[model samples]
Target: MSLQEINFDGLVGPSHNYAGLSLGNIASASHKGDTSYPKAAALQGVAKMRGNLERLGVQGFLLPLPRPNHRLAERLAYDGTEAPALRAAPWSASSMWTANAATVSPAPDTKDGKCHLTPANLVTMLHRAQEWPDTKRMLEVVFGDRDHFAVHDIVPPTFGDEGAANHMRFCEGHGSAGVEVFVYGRPGGKFPARQHEQSSRLVARQHGLDPEKCVFIEQNPVAIDAGAFHNDVVSVANERVLFTHAEAFADQQGAYNAILAAFPDLEVVEVPSDAVSLEEAIRTYLFNAQLVTLPDGTMALIVPEECRESASVWAYCERMMAGNGPIKHVIPVDVRQSMANGGGPACLRLRVVCDPATVDPRFMLDEAKADLLEKTIAEHYPEQIDPDDLWTESLEKHVVAARQALLTALGIGELA
Candidate 1:
């Protein structure tokens, strides 16, 4: 069946205290290290994007891979005679900036269930410098289901002018439906980077799509520093595109007004600054909040709201609505550490697949599960547990504890 919606899986960067590579630093290294909070937040914002996809039967998993480490080898003489220099094996570690995890089966069928590495086709810091040969090797080793895999060649140590052109050719060779490219023009300008513009146009031409279909939206150039276009901007359900502009960036009114002028027919909603802070706006806009469509065709946007001096909170509401009524608050998930290094919940989870048959609008989690999970987690653990802290380690422990309690409560197992 054809997909009604496509949600990009996200990865959280390492935490500041975690003693690993920082995602913000990795993404901004090429630009002389002017870290964009919005970009960093967008990378971290993946944590906040869970419920909408979960409700749709779309499962998100963290990508599990180490960061690549590169060091040059010193030339050594063999048997006291100077000869040809020997090469040292490449060095690398699992990526901390890129959170990675996968589904697996306990059985030994070897094909029943296994983890697969889906390549991020976009450009990334590692690929930009061409420093991740080990990453590519590791991916080839684990992914058994190669047919289902596709690469996102937009980021990093791998992307360049030639890489972009090659990506276009690869997509065309495979006859992909089309490519999704986000265009962020220079502030107060109509065009994006010349290289990006040229590459995108070439790809569109190859796909036989009208150059006009290559959706372009105006975004603050400074915001681009934060990896703004890494997530969804165009809706997978109705193709409704969402864009945001903040007064801190530039002529806020004029930039937004100009964008509105360009796409007069598209639905454009000015997000309330009061409801969401500048940092939150930057992250949410870049991460691309989960857009779920109701049976009646009305859409709901689930976004991560940065609560007053606290961790991140999720806000579920209709984007078209003026007032905040009908808004429901999901339990705040503390991602302070991840956010510090530039990522959130949504960035940590990758949506592998969605069940189309279960898209019923009425479907939702039982309210009782919330209370049960909370109580089970609290009573079993004697240590202090803050409701606001939602780090992965804490959450995983709580979830396991809650499941055991739930099983016991259901008379299905003994809670030991």
Candidate 2:
């Protein structure tokens, strides 16, 4: 089996809007009540996927989950919730950020020889809390082969589990056995720390990971309060490289010590606070990049175009690449729409390390499929979605029709 990492990016749903549901996310909060461009947002996501497909040989995508979650709407209506935000929550297309979809343990990391995936409970936010049932159904359909994969239901929602956004793994190569790192946070901060220590440990055990190879660490509450809601916003790991910000962990040095104790050859490419402040890092989503290793073995940091717009960020990137570093290329992709909603290249994707042949072909991406997705979005998706546009009968029909069109085009049966 040619074990490699395939980034399955979420196809942005038609209900994409800015109701500002996610707390501790500065971008999402600031953009509340703003009219969102759904077509452009989804297209930007598709374009990013296309870029990845062209850059790497393989790319996969998860479809727009069924939206305007009617059951949720009915329950909210019955509750007679007066809060506009709560009323609008049912229409959230936040699943477009697949990093929260699940936590995956590749074959090499587990005791059994099959890959294990646990859908995140995401119990922290009401909007996201509703995703696991549908998310699990979709996951089982795509990764259904029992011989090569084991897709488990979410760990009990008692504690929040935000999936891969809070998980990282370090290994000598893509196919090698790796040390898994689960980052959690303590409660009591101004903003809720989403990943609980108990939850991370539960997920680690649920995946049947070798206890000796697993390391659970704490996230810096300082960073969380400052809008680094998920660990991905401040750090990302690929193969042997750990690219991160200076203030990414509660005890930065201790976190390094923990990982190093497991994986001795860990090459950390740390960015100091002097060069880029945490606020600036969060704004540009510098750490929330797709740090991928190319076919030729050259590593590339796929960043949001906003990173290039930040003079300081791009300058630092140029300087880093100029040196003989592990990450040779800095590729910028346009995902501005997702960025404005508190997600970036990293947030939009879920990394599953496995053989592509083991995955359902319908879920994979190619040039022709990219064109088909583009055509579908252009023809069916609404141009814009205002907050008020959410409740109307006309818009509901349009959103439903658009998603049905996508499912038909992709040959994916309705998400049950």
Candidate 3:
């Protein structure tokens, strides 16, 4: 079976705001208290998805989760019967970054002959910690096919599993036997190492993955200090290619050696420190860009608009595309709203490799469905969502109703 890698990007939610909820994320902190454009944010995400479909000829998309988590706020013992924080309920649109949605082990890599997914606990951040319950519910609905998809409960929060953000898959092909690299951070780093080594091991075991095919690598502490909050921020892999910075992991050579041992033909594209410093790479999110094999068998880099602005980053990309490398094309996209919150193109999606026929029908997308989604966003999503608006009683009602309308429009229905 040939597996097709589909990117399921999260649609930005209606309550999208910048409350500086994420602590380690530099952009999220710097832009805290700034007014956010929820309507434009959601539409921008939709537009990016459409661009991917047109340019890459691939279609797989996810719906925005319902927001203003009053239930979760109440569970956390917040006095929701009154105003302010009660009404705010954190207003997290962080769900827009679906990269942390789950850790997926494709059928080819699993023992049960079924794709397995374990939703992230998101325990490192308070706002994100509340997301799993709803996230699990959403995944269960989207990947409900028991024969092909297994959506498992998140690991214990104490271990701190951050999902696919700390995981990467490398193989001869998606359907072939592959190596699963799980990168974890230690407690000594300036920033908290979000994904625990124990958590990654547990997830691999739960997925019934072969231990021989699993390799655990510790993230570089220097990278963490420099604000590479997640491994994906500095490194990303697809099929046989691993594109990363020179200092992406603690043992860079070890990671490369292990991967090379597993997939001998692995093409390691390392951006030397001389070409682009780690700071610039993280700042411009050069590594966070999505590296995809286009339908024509040529590869394309889906980069953030910031890359176009950075001279060094743009120059490196130009040189790579000009060479006979797997990355043959470069396409920049505008995701400023998501960028302001410390997420880039890769951060905004979860890559699932499988046969489309094995997944749920409603989750699949095409150009026609993309247009319909855009129409739905314009019709129902909010145009702007000021931080102050979250305190109003009416905003909650509108946000809830809007999500229902979106699900109804997409035929995915309401999730728990």
Candidate 4:
């Protein structure tokens, strides 16, 4: 069998109604910053997300971060970063460190697990963050790393500016024609100055997208830096844009409603204030990066299910499918630690263009191997093959099988 492409149209977002996969974070020891109750709880949350992804046959790659380093600390401090006084402000270094730390690590070539100074190796690993073993051969031999795909990149205007440009340069990544909400800069944290906004606009123009397509919104006044929550302006798929209605900070509802008004064509669903904690809400608003559209015109959000007690997973699934028919599904990943540290499922998973013909067989094979590998890896390398790692490997195998299956199924090759 050969590979096949799985349509991404319906694979994004969460649902209150249907079942789907989730991703999880590693234990606390794996995270950066001081070990505190908040950090511990976040790690447990990441565990849940990992369990969910494994159950759904999704794959995740793990990126490890070292203990607090002066280099990174100095960079963060010099960047004019601000910490919100709010307990829920999601931009705290501790939380952001948790997220960023997961994405950095000891070099693969380094046996001591020490950070590597080579920029090339660093980029290679970052690319690997989105690589799957099943698709490795095809990607390496046919497409190479230079030709890949990404749905979107939720980047910090400063640090990620060049990264985002590089993504577009190599992948030709573009924005969808749908509505987008831009949350203007917040109070305390560093906001992108007019120059930054202009730079962003220039990038959009380079991609051939209209700058007017973006709608800017304001953040809560009491909250530090409005730019911290800028990512929340648009939903995952670019189907709908969210923004603040009034300039006054702390008006969550008004801001949300304003976003709704901007896109009358979209079915605006209000996320209940009590559904998730302020911390969870802030994380959701900041970290979500994956955007996938379903076949039914509804959207699926692959985000961190912060309040496990309420099952944020099930609720999102339900909301997307409500009245729109049964074509929707929600995939809640456990990145409790990631989210607590200001990252989400979207942040952890980097999107790349996939050839459908090369993916179908792999998907099926992945399903078959998931349980087997899960048991085997868990039994042998319990500490290493965390639930997320197991799923990632299984999914890689599935992609390989999918490619072979597609070829065989189409009679393009002889069955072994």
Candidate 5:
């Protein structure tokens, strides 16, 4: 069966706040105490998804994970008392980035001819670790067609699987057999390695992927030290095209050689180190830009507004798009709220390749649905959320209520 790649973007949750809970993420730390606009952030994400559906015509939407996590509160034993550890749970909107939603093996690539999805344990960060159960539940409901879609349980926590954030696939087209690139990291720097090599291999084996088609590459320690916590921060791939920074991997040439060996038509678009340093790439999120194929059979680079704000990064993109290459245009999206919290256009989404008919209708969106979600956010979501507010009974009540209203509006029932 022919396939289309669907982008399942996580709607920013109601409890969105900046608490600097992500240890390795620079933006999260830099904007630690800043007040957040939960309503605005979610609307911004909704607008971006609407834009993708309008522009690309093949995108799907994923609802936000329930927040002000009651499970975490129960675990911490927050009996009307405040503790430093309790702060991370209520303010954790990190699940808004569903690229870490799950590691997906499309039906075309798996031996069983069933698309396999394993929700990430996300055990590296406390704030993110609590997301798997809820995420797994959502994935099961959305991709429940067991005949074609197989939703697997998360890998063991010790493995530290981070889902699609560190995984990339390459093939002639979405329907074709392809190479799965699993990028893992070892701890040798200030920033801890999030995705383990063992975790990547385990997921590959669980999905029954052909061993010959699976390639493992270690993330560059230098890149990790420079704050590229996830591979998506410095590299993104679609079809046979892999766009990456010069310093993205430990051995750039070897990674490219492996890709070339498996798929001869591989197009590696490397941003020269001279033009833009790794720091600039991470700051402007140049590599985090989504490299997607439009309906017209040509590719376009969907980048964050920060990329356009930077002279050097935008110029590089201009030059690259000017050429008669696979990438034909550049589109910038305003996800500054998400960017400020260490996510970008690419980070906000999970790419799943499958037949649209197989997905649950409630998980999909069009302009009409986007309008309803926007209306729901306007009605219930808080316009601003201060970190200090996370401690108040009123704020907690509001967050729970807001999420309940949203779920009711989306017809997904109570996920919280």
Candidate 6:
């Protein structure tokens, strides 16, 4: 195949902390005021990337966006007074969840035969809302080859878009034409629904996606209230297989029927709530996993270690594997830092299908680059960050230097 799906994971930032900035994210809320291990978190993320590179033969990583975004901090604290939420917003390392970076339409799915990407507005929350501008800039740098890629600005600020976390694609293979699905939410929920229907529709149109090949589905409000902030928290789709929970959509059967209407070959692996309750599923992040087609022609689910620790979730996996299902293997990884902050395996990545040759080499991974990154993180990253440390001058200097070291080591100081 000339084209392959590359997962671009975000390198966890040095400021990776538990500020409890994200609303509706239970893990983040529960872990507020806890000590954060920047060194271990960044190392774990690189190790995860290393695993994917070994399994898939290629991996890409996005650098951490500037932390304590002094610009945002200046604006929020211009009055010379400090509010806890406003104080923490500037220091959020939430960008590590690259799944929220952008929504991608591979070359095969677009009318122009070139990959198209639109950065998420992420207007729902303050910390995330500060992401799109920097995200768009980095996307343009890596995907700058105009003949092969088209990177669009985020949609108008009126609508909220949370990027690929709320999107899915289905096809015979990553290189073939595919049907895209956009999941949005309604107004009534205890927690604000992050993805809006208007934003999803605009992204589809901007990417030149065929209307007939796009399906829009409503997220289950109950799932949103239960802390499934993004649709990805409840469902994930590979080329032709969709492994999702029974209560994932507002109308689960109807949603499946809609997707099937567009692509008749779709395979559904539904985990009923009866077998594993929604609460247990969210806590373990059972569905927040990567379902990829392995080189050996079998499928594997790369799940969070928490999944293996949960009896119900692990038992369900065993039952699913015992059958002749499409998913053949289940690999569990440790990402406790990210997991505790409301992200699992899937949240740490953004999938873009294209020829590896078209991407900027600096962004792609090799054994040496991995070594350099780990070294920089080990030598420069802070060992631990306490909640009160967000206000310290020393922490600010250290966080900035840590990122600069990584950039210099990788010879991509332009990003710094």
User: What lDDT score belongs to each candidate, Candidate 1 first?
Assistant: 0.32, 0.92, 0.85, 0.30, 0.88, 0.93
TM per model? 0.46, 0.98, 0.95, 0.42, 0.97, 0.99
Candidate numbers, best TM-score first, in rank order: 6, 2, 5, 3, 1, 4
The lowest-lDDT stretch of 10 consecutive residues in candidate 6 is 75-84
- Of candidates 5 and 3, the better by TM-score: 5
**Candidate 6 residue-wise lDDT, 154-244, digit = tens:** 9898899999999999999999999999999987799999999999999999999999999999999999999999999999999899999
Model 5 clashing residue pairs (backbone) = none
Look at candidate 3 and give me any clashing residue pairs: none
lDDT of 4: 0.30
lDDT of 3 by residue, 1-416 (tens): 55778889998888888887765778777887788888888888888988887776676777767677767767767654544433454678888899999999999899998889999999998778888888898888777879888999999989998899999999876777788999999987677889899999999999999998898999998998888999999998988899999999999999899877766888999999999999999888988888887767777889899999999999999999889878888889999999998999998999888788777778787877877877877887777777777757887777877788788877765662
* Candidate ordering by lDDT (highest first): 6, 2, 5, 3, 1, 4
Model 5, span 207-233: residue lDDT tens? 999999999999998998888899999
Kindly report which residue stretches of model 4 are placed more than 4 angstroms away from their true locations once superposed: 1-199, 212-264, 272-280, 283-305, 310-333, 336-342, 352-416
Error of 2 at 358 (Å): 1.1
Error of 5 at 173 (Å): 0.8
lDDT of residue 358 for candidate 1:
28
Across 1-416, the per-residue lDDT of candidate 1 in tens digits comes to 23333233332222112222323332222322222222233223333434444454343222222221123222222232322111111111123223222211111111322222323323323222232333344334323234433222223322222121111100111112322333333423321221233434443333334343334333344444444322222111122333343433234565334434534433434445565554555443323343344434455544434432323313313232445422222233444434433444434433323223322211112334334433543454223222222233563354345435434643433112
Q: Where in model 5 is the C-alpha error above 4 Å? A: 79-85, 414-416
Q: Which wins on TM-score, candidate 4 or candidate 6?
A: 6
